[model samples]
Structure formats: C-alpha cells, structure tokens
Target: MDGKVIFIGGGPGDPELLTLKAYNVIKKADVIIYAGSLVNRDVLNCAKNDSIIKNSASMNLDEILDLMEKSVKNGKLVARVHTGDPAIYGAIGEQIEGLKEKKISFEIIPGVSSFFAAAAALETELTLPEVSQTVIITRPEGRTPKPSAEAISKLAKHQATMCIFLGVQMIEDVVNDLLTHYKPETPAAVVQKASWPDEKIVKGTLNNISNKVHEAGITKTAMIVVGDVLDTEGITPSKLYDKEFTHEYRKGQLN
Candidate 1:
C-alpha cells in the first residue's frame, strides 16, 4: 500500500465533540469512509473539499476493505470514522483482522463515548465513593450473539453501574433480564442522540424505564445506563478532596 488508513472515533454526534487529532485527520484525509446511518453528517464538514467520502451503511465488509485497500494503494490518506469511541462495540476488530491479512498499516484514535456524554447530560458521576465502583458496558443479545456468561442477567448480579449499547429498542426484554438481579427500584436511564440538538434523556427506575423510554419514542441510537450510580442520594463524599483523607500529596488534618 502507498499510504496508511486511520480509524477515528467521531464522538457522539456534536461536531464540536471531535478531538483535535480527529479534526486534523479529517482535514488532511484524501478519502473518508463513515457509518452513515449512525454518524452525524455535520462531522464531515471538516473534510477536505476534494476528499472522496463514502457511506458504509449500505456496503458490505468486503466492500469497505476494498475501498480502503484501493485508497491506500493510490498513496492517499484514508480516514475510517465511527460514531463514539471506536473500541466499544464499534466492530473494528474484524476490520483490523482484514487489514492484517492485507498488510495495510493503520492507527486507532479514541474518542468520547456516548456513555460519557450520557453522564454529562445527566450531570452525574457513574461511580461514587459509596455507590457503584464498576461500570459494566454490554448489550443484550440481538442479531449479534453474546456469550452466555455475559448475559444482562448475569452482569446485573454485580450491582455495578451498567452502560448498555444498542439495546434501547428492546427495552422491555432488557428490563426483564436486569430485573433478575437488580432491584426494581434501581435507577435506570436512557440518553438518545446525546450531544445532538435533538438529544433526549429518560430517567426512571428499572420498574418503569421500559415504558418511559417507549413513551419518549426513543427506539435506537441511545444509551441505557443503570445501577445505584444513577442515584446520588446519601452517597458518601469522595475522599480524594476530603480534608480527613491522607495520601502521598498531603497529610490528613486530625486534631
């Protein structure tokens, strides 16, 4: 190949959310391939005027690789963009494997995930001193099969905070699976089109989140976060900034 391919995480939906590195890559790219159905079109505004841009939504895996291989062979810099952090459920693994077989060099650039944007939208932390210290990111099985051990019901037993991706359309089933271990009163939330102009959030308990999400008409392109982390009531304050806490930085103030 004459050039390299760069896989970029385009962030949630806001063009401003693009990292400086991602912005520069888009600006310098000679070709851009992106997920059209899920990615925000505005993110492409930074692309070079003469850049070759293609939407991968209608293309098969082989087609995507073919384009990348061709572009790289032509001595052109190609940008492969995906919404949110490309590492999480971004399906980059298969592409990486294909690249390896073809010996096409590439690099990955991480971006702000929708779960983080969802937390920002809710103005809450996913982890707290006395609340959940774990954030389990998974998706309920759909056409994409998941390991039996990683079932939503099994993950719920940890009582850790959860960031479910691509499961909003099946909210009822997800709630049912979560109910197997999580309390019905446990807080749950859904953030749709996070960071976008029409972003919407649905907050409630597991007992009612399914109905609430349906009522809000959020079917897809959303994040489902659940656990005690969503509830900040009576949580112990973090000790990092507490005067009573001691660390390598300072001594505890004790009289």
Candidate 2:
C-alpha cells in the first residue's frame, strides 16, 4: 500500500531476541538500513531476499535520509534497524528530524535494551526495596557533552542501582567519578557482549572493578552495573509478595 519507514530495535546481539513485530517488519520491507557492527548478522538475515540492505554506519545522516525519502516516495517499505532499543543511544533523533522535514511517515518498534540484557546475563534484580529502589541508567561523558546535572559524579551521589553504558573504554575515569559518592567497597559488575555467545561477566566491588575489567580486556560492547543489588548477601523479599502485604489483587494475611 502506501510507503512508510519503520525503525526496528534488533535487541542486543541475539537474533532470537528480536521482537516478533520487528521480525515481521524486516520480512516484509523492501529496503533495510541497519547499523553496522552494532547489529548482529543473524538479525539482518531475517530480511527478505530481495530487500535492499545498506549499512548506515558507512553513510552519514544526509545519505541515510536520502535513501529513506527516495524509497518511501516510491511506495516501498523501508526498515531502519538499530542495535538494542532504538530509544537508548540509538542516534536516531537526527534521522527522525530529517524525515519530519521531508514529511515522511515513520513508526518505531521497541526492542530490548543492552542494559536489560546485561541484567539478564547477571540474573539479578535491578530494584530491591531496602537496598535500592531506583535504577539509574547513565553514561560517562566523552566527545558528547553531558549536561552538568547528568554528570557521572553528580549522579553517583544517589547511591542507587546504576547501569553505565559506553564508559567501559574509560572505566577508570568512570570509577573515579563514581567514587565521589559511592564507597570503595560498593558492589560493581561489568557484563560484556551480553546475550552474545562470547559474553563475559566481571563481578567485584568498586575498589577492584576497573582493574578487573581492564585485565579482562573488555574495551567495548559492555554494560557496567553498580549498587548493592548485585551483592545478594542479605536481600529480603519485597513487600509486593509478602504474605502480610495487602494490595488490590490480594488481601493481607495475618499470623
């Protein structure tokens, strides 16, 4: 029917992790543009045999928008694929703005983020009632200018569960910033290539995480998680499931 551009989240590096909707969009699209290195080859293989596939990494924003505009105008379906969830660090904002200027129709399909995948790889709950109920997702500022309020050091003061992205390459700096508020013995973990066959996990306190990660040679594609939740030393059950806890679904039970 009419032409449209659908942005799909490839979900980490596992092809099977692709949402059913994402897989279906890839199967029916006439053109596919995926982020190179970020997306797994197996996920790209879901595209129809005749689908025109292009690596977005090799092209600039103008080139990418040009392709979508041309394809949509020609009444062809274009699937713009990104690694993990398109919302988190997917870099799709500029492309979306471009599509708007050209008046192109587009839809976004959500995918599993690497941070959640990292959580799954560790088999740990991100939120614990008494330990830390807040999970702060952040990154260390690099070439990208981070706002003062979102600075790593400032965010560290909360001492809540923290998942750091794109900072493994400069983990020492990250740890240094974190140490501004977090204790040296605070639990920390690094999960590299989560959900991939070559995934690696490193668990340690803040005092040793940087060295452990460096020794493990994890320079990229890793998720750094910190907080008391990872320790699991004396985690207690949540109020949600407590026998004496009352809610809309169930009445409180008394001893």
Candidate 3:
C-alpha cells in the first residue's frame, strides 16, 4: 500500500524519554491513536495542531484498526502511540496482523520500557555478579492465564532478578508466591508510575513488600522488582571495569 502507519512507543510516562524518531513521527502524523490512560498526555503535544487524535483506551481492537484503515485509505499517515516498548505487552500483534491483512506498510519505533525506568528511579541494576546474573520479566496470571511452566511459582525457582508487570493489583498473591522460592529478606521494591512527576516507590523485603504496597495504595501502573540487587549495600564491582580483568580493549593489571 502507498499509505503507511507508524507504531510509536511513548515511553513510561515521560515525554523527555521519547525517541527522536517517535517524536518526529508524531509531529508529522495526520492521524494519531494514543493509549490515553497509560501514556503521558504531554507527549501528545508533539502532534501537529491539525492532526486527528483519538484515545484508544476505550476502543476495542476492531475499532482502532478500523480508524487506522480508514485513515490510511485516505492517504494519511497514521501513528499508533503506545506506552513503553510496544513489544512488551503493548498488544500490537493483533493490530499488526490486521494491518498486514489490509496490505498497509508500517514501522515500529521503540521507546524506553517501564522496567528500565523503574530501575533508573531506584538506582538499582537487575543483574549483579555473584548475586543475580539473570533477569526475568513476567507477570502474575490474571485474566490472561500464563502457561504452567511460566507460573510465578516455577519462575521464582531461578532466583533471578524479576520485573513483574501489570500485577500490582495482585501484589499480595505475587509476594506470597515469590516467598515460595525467595528468602523472606530478599530485597524487593515496587515503583508506581515510574518517570511520572508524582511517582512513588516502596522498598522492603518479601515478607513486608505487600503491606508497603498496600499502604501506598498503588493498585495499578506499578512495576515490582525483586532480587538481592536492590540491596546495594556492598555489591562486587563488575569484572568489566576491574583493573585486574583483561579484555581486548585493555591489558590486565594482574598480567
């Protein structure tokens, strides 16, 4: 098709986090479909004043796709804006499939995901040597039931740093299931609306994080991070920066 559509990741509630490509696309878009409830409204300001903007929060997949199809058929540039990286639970698969069926050309411009923003806000790394060399990103089973193998109870057994998304409403159940594999004192934290102006963070252990989150009243729009990396009291420095470690870029001091 001659008409094109662009899927832009708006990042996690921070207009400044938007990529240059996404910003430019929004500015040039003839039609913009934004996830209003989750994306920061400030990013919408980038769109041309005459652009046709619609909130997809209340719109179903068919409705949204219809809008895009109509706009594209009229030879207009349609921009589908999603919060955070669209690849991560952005539900763009169905939309892409629909676009393909209609033979519409499209491009995806990725943005910063909430998990990375949460990590930045907490000043914590997901992977730490000798602590947690792996990071797992998943969510608790809800209306969308995950495979039994991907269940929290089973994933927790790895003891890797985990970033739980869209599970704040089920924080208690999440913590309880995590306790099955993590120690009571394993450092855990919850970041609400990361990168937003009024963002909130609750830090505690497996035994107390639920209460803390409950007291904070963060029912949604939060990310749960669990691992020893949160306990940044005395982590070993990475070998990459170690003077004694050798690499192609530098000689080992020990040698």
Candidate 4:
C-alpha cells in the first residue's frame, strides 16, 4: 500500500476559509500534522476521532520529516497542514525538499492567504485603477535577510500597495524604512489575526501606524497594509465594470 502526503493550507485562522479539498483531505487523513501556533485548532474538528494528530510547533525540520517518513512507510495517508497559503511564509519548502529526497509522494493544496483576508476585513481593495497597479507582498529584514533589490525601502519607491507579513513585531523599523519613499501621511493599516473571531484592525498614516499598533498591543500574527488604496475617498472605479467599456465578454455600449 503506497502512502502519500498532502500539504494543506489552513487559511489564516478561519476554519471556514479552508478550501473544500483541504477539508476533505483532513477528514480522510490517517495522520494529521498541523502548525499548532498559527493554525486555528477548530480545524481539527474535521478530522476523524481516531486520527493521529501531531502538532509541529515544537518540532524541528528533521523531527517532522522523521514523523512523515515513518507514517508514509506504514502506508498512512498524512495531512501536513500549515497556516494561510503554504506557499507564503509557511516554510514548507524545506519539508518538500525532504520529502522529495525520501521519494515520498506529495501534493500542495492552496488556500486563502492572510493578506486577502485582511483586505476583506478592512473592506478595502489592495489595487485600484490609476492608484496602484501592483501589490508588493514582503516583510522587513529580520533574522532572515532579504535581497537588497527587494528591501522594503527599495520596494517602497514604487509607492505600490504593500502587504507586509512577519513584520508587525518590527513596526517602527518598517514604518521608518517605508517613510524613505512614501509620504508621512500615506495611509497604513494593520490587521491582527485576520478572519479570526477576535481579530483587531488599526488604521492610521505612515507617521502614526507604529504608535497605533503599539497601543493595540499587536506584536505578531498581523499584516501591515500600506498605500493610498486604503483611502476610499478618491479612488477611481475599475473600467472592467464600466457600462461603456468593451471587452471579450461585453460590447461597448457607447461609441
């Protein structure tokens, strides 16, 4: 009996935000390994009563791989779950590499990322025509160094909407770096544990966001959104929805 591993994105702390495929896989998994610190425990409700569940929070890469390898050899279907989309900051690349080296079969299922959830919670669009055409998803340089070309200050030069991950703990530095390019009054917002029941949102300008976040006591598990898109006062509506615009799906009404 050949076994396999499925990497499921748990979707930003909201169990409902999980993809249907992920839910099904969790339900059918013979063994489930999840990121206990970040993933919502409620998601475990989908698993069988007798399923073997392990929390990877305290486990290192080798220990995790050992568990996966042992489970696979025993012909058990394993579900390796991570918070938000596995592709983003979930640190699954190392795990995937280990699996490949061991000749283990695996598949990655996508899920709703925290940034999108944070955007939805704020009821703001990350991109608005003529305002911002690009969204930069990045984090401040911490223990893990970022490429010089992708540094926050460098990226801020475009003044594009930025959704920063793993930087809330360094909000002051993040704000300072962003200020190098963005204006002092540039709109910024932080959403902590987006989509969770007790989620918190703090909105302010680049000059004051750090203070606001500090007041709110948001140290981690937060997304920092910056740019003019948060300004709902003067945004231009998308042309795609304009009644006069023509496209492959619609003909121009005015000509």
Question: By the lDDT metric, which is better: model 2 or model 4?
Answer: 4
Give the TM-score of each candidate: 0.98, 0.98, 0.98, 0.98
Worst 10 residues of 4 by lDDT: 232-241
True lDDT of residue 89, candidate 1: 84
The clash numbers for all candidates, in the given order, read 0, 0, 0, 0
Judged by whole-model lDDT over C-alpha atoms, candidate 4 comes out at 0.94
Number of the top lDDT candidate: 4
Please write out the lDDT profile of model 3 over residues 1-255, one tens digit for every residue.
Answer: 356899999999989999999999999999999999999989988788899999999999999989988888889999999999999999999999999998888999999999999999999988888999999999999998899999998999999999999999999899988989999999999999999999999999998999998898989999999999999988899999999988999988974
State the lDDT of candidate 2 residue by residue for 47-121, as single tens digits.
888999998878999999999999999999999999999999999899999999999999999999999999999
lDDT by residue for model 1 (42-140), tens: 999989899999999999999999999999999999999999999998889999999999999999999989999999998889998878788999999
lDDT of each model, Cα atoms only?
0.93, 0.93, 0.93, 0.94
What TM-score, to 2 decimals, does candidate 4 have? Answer: 0.98
Candidates in order: C-alpha RMSD to true structure: 0.9, 1.0, 1.0, 1.0
Q: Give the poorly placed runs of model 1, Cα more than 4 Å off.
A: none
Model 1 deviation from native, Cα RMSD in Å: 0.9
Which portions of model 4 miss their true places by more than 4 Å?
Answer: none
